[model samples]
Target chain A: MNIPMSEPITYLEAIRHAQTDCLHTDERVFIYGEDVEDPLGGAFKATKGLSTRYPERVLNAPISEDAIAGMAVGAALDGMRPIIEFQFADFAILAFNQLANHAGAGAWRHGQPCPLVARLPVGGTPGGGPFHSQMVENWLTTPPGLISVAPATVSDAYHMLKQAVRCDDPVMFYEHKALYFHQRASLSNAPEYPLGRAVVRRQGQDISLVSYSAMVWDALSAAEQLARDYQIEAEVIDLRCLKPLDMNTLYDSLEHTGRLLVCTEAWPYAGVSAEVIAQVSSQAFHLLDAPPRRLNAKDVPVPFHPHLWNAYRPNTADIVQAALDLVRF
Target chain B: MQKIPILLPRLGEAVAEATVQTWLCQSGDTVAKDQDLLEVETEKSIIAIPAPAAGVLLDIDKPAGSRCQVNEVLAWLHSNESDVVQPVDSGSPHAAPTPTETSPTHTPTASLASNSGRHGFLSPRLRALMQEQGLTELDLHLLRGSGQHGRIKADDLTQLLEHLQSHYEPHPAGMLRQAVADSMSRSWNRPLATVSSAVKMDALLAHRKTLPERPSASVYALSTLAQALKEDGRIAKLLLGDQLWQAQQIDLALAIDVDNGIYNPVIQSVDAYSLGELAVEVKRLIAQAHERQLPSNGHNTGIATVSNYGSLGITWATPLPPPGHSCLLGLGAVRRQPDWHPATQSWQCIRACEITLTFDHRIADGGTAARLIHRIVHLLEHPDLLS
Candidate 1:
C-alpha cells in the first residue's frame, strides 16, 4: 500500500509515513504488537496509518514479547519480513528472552536468520517516570549476535525502520521520544539505512564522543557546546547499530583524535558501555592515548523524580564534561 | 636571464598525477634554499617540495590542485644577485637571451623523461592489476617486465609483487632484533670460549613435579642457575655488548624459537617468575609464540639470552649470543641415558643434559666463560636451591 502522495510531515507525521511507506515497499514487510490496529494504532502514533493501508499485513497480538518475537521469527523463517513494536522501551524486557537467547543467536550460530524489527519508544521527557523513560538500547546491544539501533531523526526513524525490517538479522530499533519531535537534518527523503553501520553526525578530531538513542542527540549537543565554550572539537558518532558495531568508523575517528568518550544511559558495569570500550581498545589500541571513558548511567536504577533522574542519567553537560576530560587525558 | 619551464617533481613512484595539495609559501615569500614551498599528494603520500634556491618567489606558475608533470614550472624566484656560475658559452638546457653565465635562473639542461621512458601499451587487464597493488618505481625496476621495452605492465607485477610483499616476505623484526644484533656483535668480537658440562637434570624435574603449585612459589632451576652464576663477580657486571647494547633493557630473552621471526616474547623478569610462575610463564610464552598472541611485548631489551635447545630434543648445538647479553648456556635435550662417573664406578641410566656456553671472545677470555658455565652447572646439578 503506497502512501497516498501526501503532504510534508512533522516528526510524528514522518513516523506514520515510515510504517505505511514500509508496508507499501516490501510485500514481505508487516507490522505487529499490542494495540497496533486502526482503533489504537500502537501505544505511540507510529502505526496510526499503517493498519488502515495494509489490513491483512498489519497485525495485533497479545502482550507477550516472547510470543511476539517467536511469531516474527516464524514469519521470517517462512519468508515474511515482520516488525513488532514494544509499547515503551521498558516493555522490551518481556521480549529479551526470545531476542537474547534465540533470535539474537540463531543467525550467527545456527545459520538460520530471524529477520525482525522490535520498535521501542525510549528516553525521559514530559514526566515519563522510571518505567516508561528507560533507555535500554544498551541492554539490547550487549549480545554480539544482534544489532540495536537508535535513530534521532524522523528520516532515520522512517528509513532505518524500513531498513531494519528488511535486514536478514534482528534489530532492536529504538526511537528516542525527545527526538521524535525535535531533531532535524538536511535530509530530503529518509536515507537508505545500512544495518550494522555507524554514521558520524558531525566531523571533528579533538575528541571522539560516541552515543546512541536519546544520548546521541545529547552528544551532538555536547559537541556544539564544547566547540563554542572551550574550542574543543568533538566528533559525535551516532552508533546506529550497536552490535556488529561499525568498529571501523570508531577506529578511524579514534586514530585522529586518540581519545574516546562514550555517552550512554546504560549502567557502567558489564553493560553496553563495557563492550564499546573493549571493542575500541582492542581494535584501536595503538591509536588511543588513554583508555576510553564513559558518561553512562550510574551504577543504580533510573530514578523517579526529575532531579534524581537528571542526576542518575548522563545529560548534555555530562557528555560535554566527559569529552573535555578525554582531551585533557 | 633564462626562460625555463619548471616541470612538476615526481612524488613517490606510484603517482601518475598530483593535485597540488597545498602551496605553503606564497608568491614573493622570501624562501631560503631547501625550504619547502608546497605540499603535493599523489593518492598515497603527501610530500613537501623544497625550494631549489635562496630567493624571493617571483611567480607561482602552477595553481594549487592542478595536475602537472615533474619538470613543469612550479614557481619562479629572483635571487639577490647573478654571477658567472657557469660559462655563458656552455649552453645548458635553458632558454637564455643575455647569455650571462648565471642570471639567477634555474635552467634545465636535461629534458624531463616523459611518457617516453616506459611507453609500452599496457593491456587493460595488466593496467588494472598494476593499479590494484599500488606498486612503486623501485618495484617496477625489480620486476622483470615482459611488456614492451621491458616496462613493467600491471599484470606482470601484480601477481608477483603481491606474493613477494605479502606472502613470501619475512615477517619484520620486532623489538627483539635490536637486542639480538647488539648481543651477537659483542659476543662475536669478544675473546670467548665455551665450557661444556653434562649434568643430571632428574632432581630438577622431580622437584618441579613435587612442588604444590602456588603463585608465590620459588622459581626452579633457572633461579638457581642465575644465583650460582652471580657467584662469579664478573659474570653479572657485563654481558657480550652484542647482547646488551642493541636491545633496551637487561631483560633476559630466552630463545624458544617456534619457526617464526617475530614470535619471541620475553618473560619480563624470569628470575622473579617462580617455579610455578616459571612453568606458567614458559607455557604462556611458548603458546603465544606459537599462536602469534604475544604482540608488541618486546619493547624492553634483553641483557642476555638462554637457548634451552636440549629441553626440546636438540642437544649440543652452539647458540648465537644475542646482541645485548654476552653469554648463552645451551642445554642439550634431557633424556634417559647411561652415565659413567668415577665415583659411581659403574654405568647407570640417568636423566642427563649437556650445556654448551657460547660467550663473547672480545669481552671475556675462555677462563671467565668456563668459570661462569661451571657455576651454572653447579646450580643445575643441585636442584635444592631451585626447590
Candidate 2:
C-alpha cells in the first residue's frame, strides 16, 4: 500500500514500512529481537504494530544478544530470512562472533547463503552515552562476507531495507538513531538504484565532501554554507553502502574538483572515513590537487553530556572548516 | 590591566611555520605599537613580528629558537587601555586576525632566496601536462604561479592555456625564430653592461672611397673590434664559476636582419682576413643567414658579435650578445655635427657616429670596456690602420 503523499515519512517510519511490506509479501521473513513482541514493540517503537499484525513472524527473544544472533544465523541457513535487532549498536559486539564468523563467512565456507538482516540503531543522540550510541559499521564492514549499508535519506531507508531482506547474503543495516525522527522525505515509489552505490546529495565544483548516514546531512549543510560564505562549491556524496564502496562515483567527483574532504561520525582510527580516504589516495592519486583529508568524531567514547556529545561528533562547522582547508590547499 | 595575545601573522602562502630567532625586547619592557618585538625566520625569509598595541610585555610564550605555527600566540601583553585589545571570537577558531590586520614587518633575508629562476616542485598533473605540451622547466619558469609558495599548479597551467585559447591566436615560431628566442633568453641571465663612445668616421669613409673594393662601415667596425680583442684576449674570457675559459679564436658573429627574425651567423677569424676578404665573407654570411642556410655545427660559437642597427637608421642602440659569446659591438647611424678646430678658429661639419660595446660585466669591469671601446674608436678614426 502506498503511504499518503500529504504527510512526509520519517526515516524511522520508512524503515517500519519496509519491514511491514516484507512481512506481508514474503512468508519466510520474520523479525526476532529483545522486547520486540506485541504491546511493547521494539525499544524505539520501530516494530510497534508488526507483532500484533504478524504474531507468528514477529517473536520476542531474551536479552542474550549472542543467542539472538546465533538463532538468526541458524534460521537463515535453513532457508528462512531472519531480521535481528540490537537494542543499540554498542550492544551488537556481544554477537560479533556469530555475525562476523558464522553468518558472514557461511556462504563462502558451506556454499549456503545466510540471508539475515541485522537492524542496528547506530550514531549519536543528545544523551546516548558510550553504551547506547556507537557506529558499528566499521567493525562489521571489516569482515569479508558482510554487506554493510548506512542509509541517510528516507527513500533509501524504505527501499534498501527491503532490498537487504531479499538479498541472499547477510546484510548489516546501520540506521542512524538521530536521523530517525529528524530526517523526513516524501515516500516515493519510483525505481531505486541497486544497493552498494553512492548518491550525490549535492552537486558542486570546488571540493568533494564524502560522508555517510547522519554525517551526510551535516555535509550538505556545510556545502551550503561553504557556497554562501566562502564562495566554495562543495559536492556532497552519501555512501549508502560502506562495504562495497562505489569508488567510480568518488573518482568522477574528484576529477571535477581536485580536492576531497570526508566526514564521518565514527572515530578516526580504522573506520569508514579512513577507508574512503585511503582508497582515493591510492587509486585516484593523479586526480587530487590537494592531499585528501578526513574529519571524524573525536577519538573518544561517545560522551554522556549533551554539550560533550555535541563536541564529540563531527558537525557542520567542522565539515566546513575541513572543506575550506582542502579547497584553499 | 588586561592581558592580550600577540599572534604570529602569516608570512606567505607557502610558509606554514617559522622559528623564533631572537627577541628584540625582554619581558616587562614597554613597547609601542608596530615596534619590532621579535625576529622569526621562515622558509621564505626573515620577518620581524610587531607589537599589536602599545603595552608592557607580560611574558614570552615561545622562547628563542622555538618554532611556531601561523596565528599561534607568541606572547601576552598587559595594557592599561582595554580598547587596544581586539576581541577574538571564541565560537570559531578560524575567526582570528588576518595577516593584513596584524601587519608584521617582513624583511627578506639573503639566506632563503626566491625560486624564480630555479625549478621548484611540480605537481604530477602539471608534469603530465608539461610533457604533453613539450614544455621544459625554462618555459615553466616564465609562467607566474598563483599557487602556494609560488608553485605552478595544474590549474594555473590549464588556465593559462585557456586564456591563450580565448584571447590570442597562436602561430608557430619556426626553427630559426625559436632558436633565437631560446638563446636570447639564456643570455639574458648574465650581468650585461653597455658602453658607448663617439667616433669620427670621416677618415674611415674617405679611406673606403679610395679603395677599389669599398667595405661597408659594419665590415670596417667588425674588423676593428676583432683586432682590438686580439691585442687583449684576456677581456674575451668567459667567466665560468670560479674559473675563466679563454677563447681559442677571435671569431665574431654578424647580426643579419632577416625576414621576421634576426640571425647572428659567425664570421670566423675576422682579424686574420684583409678588408676586402673580410667584406666578402660578411656579405656571404649575411646572404646565408637570410636564406636560413647557416651551418648548425660549431660555426655559430663566437667570442663577440657586431650588429649594424644603424643600417635601419637607428641613431643609437645597445644590442645584446648571444649565448656562448662574451661581448657585442653595435654601430650607430652616421650623423654630421659641427666641430671646432681651435687652430683654424672656425667650426666645420664632420661625419660622426657612436659605437657601443655591450659585454658581460662579470668577465670584465667598466674600465676594461672603456679601454676596449677607445681602442676600436682609434682604429676606426685611422682608416689606414684598418686596411
Instruction: Report the error of model 1 at residue B322, Å.
Output: 20
On lDDT, the candidate that comes out on top is 2
- On residues A112-197, what C-alpha lDDT tens digit does candidate 2 reach at each position? 99999999999888898989888888899999899999999888998999999999999999999999999888875544878989
Please provide, for model 2 over B286-345, each residue's C-alpha lDDT reduced to its tens digit, 9 standing for 90 to 100. 778777787764744788999999899997997779977889999999999998979999
What lDDT does each candidate get? 0.66, 0.83
All candidates: DockQ: 0.01, 0.19
Position B200, candidate 2: lDDT: 94
Clashing pairs in 2: none
Residues B163-242 of candidate 1 have per-residue lDDT tens digits of 78776765555545644544455555546566688878776767666666632111343455455544443544354335
